[model samples]
Target: MQKEEFIAIASKVSEGLATDQQKQLFLYHLGTFAKENPEWEKLDLGFRQQIEDEIKSDIRIQVFGEAKWKPKTTRLWPRIVAIAAAVAFIILGVYFFNYRNDKHLDIDNLVMQGVGPGKNGATLTLADGKKILLSDAVKGQLANEAGVSISKTEDGQVVYKVVGVRANEAGKNNTMTTARGEQWVLELPDGTRVWLNSASSLTYPAFFAKTGSRKVELTGEAYFAVAKDKLHQFIVKTKGQDVEVLGTHFNINAYPEEESVKTTLFEGRVKVSPFYTQGEALSEGEKATVLKPGEQSVLANNTIKVLPANTEQALAWKNGYFMFENENIKSIMREVSRWYDVDVIYQGNVEQKTIEGTVSKFKNVSTVLEMLESTKVVKFKINGKQIVVMPGKDNN
Candidate 1:
């Protein structure tokens, strides 16, 4: 385009009367002009002087009158000022719109709203079928079974130590089970660590066998940190599935109420499949959820989905907190009831409501429920140990 035409377009852009297409063209020209005129050090001053001179000479005369200030029927100065204001608004609108849209595209908010740590409550079952309330147990050695000394740590971990037994003869089978309102931590003979969730049990030899694979059976949910032993593969056998790993940390959710057994691998490799199936393996950063024998690692519909391992949420119970990220009221209550040893009953159709936050397990059940109710979605009434969850009315 001619310099006059370019200058006119630039003037229109400066006055905010240019269309989007025209503004784009003006920006292109301005870029090229800047690149070609590298020696123009006083760039801003030069442009301002040029615009000021043009506005005073041409635009001013067109708007007001000649230099002598002759009164004219049409006043152009007001229109120019209005146009300039409009242009500034348009520029600001475009910048803010783009910025807001980019922020809306981020996934951080969504992730922050869903999934959290498990709650407290884990019981222990003695060999003679007697149950011991673990959560209230005094911190020290509770008992010894066979060659293993079972001690409850100050942090509420049920640690099993091999005593008065040869390392080679360490594999005497002992089982530790947690009741509905409890969770437990066990340290295996090979230095492997297991965090047992509420309503779960882990069966392993008192001392790991020196020869074959170190295997343990689990029910419900547990987080495992397998000790490194290439020669002795560590295997976790649940009701329908088994996870085999050399050394790694992962979580296994094999709840009977849930249809699938989910194994989330956080670090290292693991092979997970149904107890009867063979050759099916899930690598690191992958979750193997077995619904049935032949079904692959997949979340079919909303009923059964195998999500990638969210370590913080999956092992939150082990870390002494309840973390909920966009978790539905029903699911959240299920966890709350399990850990606090309470029966949760819903008074209305409030399953659709969800909560997102983290709370310390050290807090009592009522305190945690109060925090959840603060979100204004649900309310709780504690009758004895039973918690009645009801939709909060406008007043409550």
Candidate 2:
């Protein structure tokens, strides 16, 4: 294909107006022409110049001050979007693959820009403690455990469909566990929807039958959209406390490594048991505190600390982005460690700085870490599976 033909195809691809046949032809031409002439890879110079002009003027700027990056309270998409938009036209309609071919980007290449995010896979433990790997299970009815029909979908979700005869009969309990760098969604027998994050596990009855109330034990973080069962209260039990609600949308962060367990309510009301009195978290015989929508209850120091919740931040993992706001390097690294399945080792005092940005969780580990390094607050050295974080020049 000629340069003019390639430009026309790129315009259509960028605008998302190409037909299925047109898209195929465009891709075929790209493979052939791009291989023969490297200069014609991205849009010709004429088209790129136009995009560059549009980007510089309208793109929102999020500034990083000094070697020690300053605190930021800025939006994410408006910043790098112009550049991403420009590249979308050139790179086969990839949405957020913000890549650059530069000598300074050697680390990026080592990390392999194609290293994408984790997907759904988990271990399902039956009442008999039989651990079944869901990834190995076929896409269909997995089993009929305790009269509940368990099935796996192509989209990577486990669904429990309650049978008619045993609708009120209690089935054996089951547990779903996702290790580091894994995630899985579950649709409980009670119709509740759960999005489980990495390094988390949940245990519940196979059937909600004949129970006084619905209860589940959680050992990690999860977002719940409870199905409204007015007669049956939904209670989530953690090491710290129990979150009881009728029907609500909420997120719970109860990782054992963290200092406290946080329950952020997005809709309806929830009662956090063993309510706090003050700064303490692990006190005995605490009372229950009711939290309204948009409030978060932090179980720490033997008390329930209530604060306003950022709903978007709580749901970022499920939405496929790493959203940070006034978060320190150590806290952010902990999350990266789980999602990327890498061990984090700190060097010097790297937690002195804060980061505020949004990047694609689906990107390679290098891209995600590079986003932080861009702020100049921290530097990372990849040593096999372990990442050592060091302080930036200003902090030194």
Candidate 3:
């Protein structure tokens, strides 16, 4: 394409008017020049301005370098910073969002400890008041209550299949809880799939509501792919919020300790209702706010705040990784505390420290700690099941 055409389309991209296809073409042209020109920093009049000039010019045509591969647009935003960040993320193998904006870490001065990561383990509390440790339950039938067969699958899932009737008996409600260092997947009788994160619990019925919608209570974080039943909506109720869906996929983090409950919709749509008065009477006339895909609803201060979501980052745990962007030290360590089954103790004022990176949750706790230490802002010490997060060597 000619320079005029490239400029026109690129202007639309900067203004957020270009479609994904147009953005892909622009990214290809820009990413190609960026790769070819490795000396951008040396001749940079700010990275964005230099990139715009090179993209419009045939720097490749000067030598007319052979075109090789096309740059795919994984994400796009109107700002130039966002575009640059996305391209850099593509180059670095991490989902690029906001970059780090805190005090730089002193990576050379750090301490590390080795603690194993959390694994698949949970406890299922049957309606009959029997507690079965799922981690040790040999793959077979676990229990049968109200004609619903409960089994432990080979892949560490708790499956509930209806054998006879879909009854909402008073004594047929089941609860599954994961400890600090545990996680599990649950398949309901109606075919909806739920992935429960560490230190979480899900209380569901033997069968969905016989008359109205399917209902479940949750604590902690969970990802849900609700099975479609247009006639009976699926409702996820937590301490502070209720999410209603017909047939959609969404995630909820409603740990009671958290200041707010966050609900992010990845695919399909969901209606989120944040409670203003806890334990307030709820009649069938209660209303909720609808959230679309790529949107998140934050229930805090008894208000619902909707914002654009980074679905990839939100679903990172389900994908076997812990991803963060500009997150404070305490928050990151809290995740560490849950996954590694450890308690976090702060030495002094360390809340100002922040990090931006991605690391596999499958690794030993030391690997994650080391990644944080590399930022040079903080260091950690492991004493049995207690982790003491203190200032870095530089701070010392």
Query: Model 2, 83-189: lDDT tens per residue?
Result: 23333232322222221221232222336334455766799998878887997888888878766789997766899998756555567789999998888888998
Candidate 1 Cα outliers beyond 4 Å, as residue runs: 1-172, 276-306, 392-396
| Model 2, runs deviating above 4 Å | 1-115, 167-169, 275-286
Q: Which candidate should be chosen as best, given lDDT against the real structure?
A: 3
In model 3, what lDDT does residue 57 have? 55
Please report, in order, the local distance difference test score of every candidate based on alpha carbons: 0.59, 0.70, 0.71
Per-residue alpha-carbon lDDT of model 1 for 1-396, expressed as tens digits? 554455566567545477655644544444334334322222223233443454546554533434443232343433333223222222111111111112232111111121222344456665555566666778898877766687877656677777865465545566777777666677886789887888888888767767788999898889888999999989888766667889987888777766566667767777765443246464432344432221223222212344455445565565445667777778888778777677788787776555666655544565566566656567776667677877754213
Which one is best on TM-score? 3
Give the better candidate number (1 or 3) by TM-score.
3
CA deviation > 4 Å runs, candidate 3 = 1-114, 168-171, 278-287, 393-396
Give candidate 3's error at residue 261 in angstroms: 1.0
TM-scores for all candidates?
0.56, 0.70, 0.72
Global fold similarity of model 3 (TM-score): 0.72
How much is the lDDT of residue 223 in candidate 2? 90
Top-down lDDT ranking: 3, 2, 1
Better of 2 and 3 by lDDT: 3
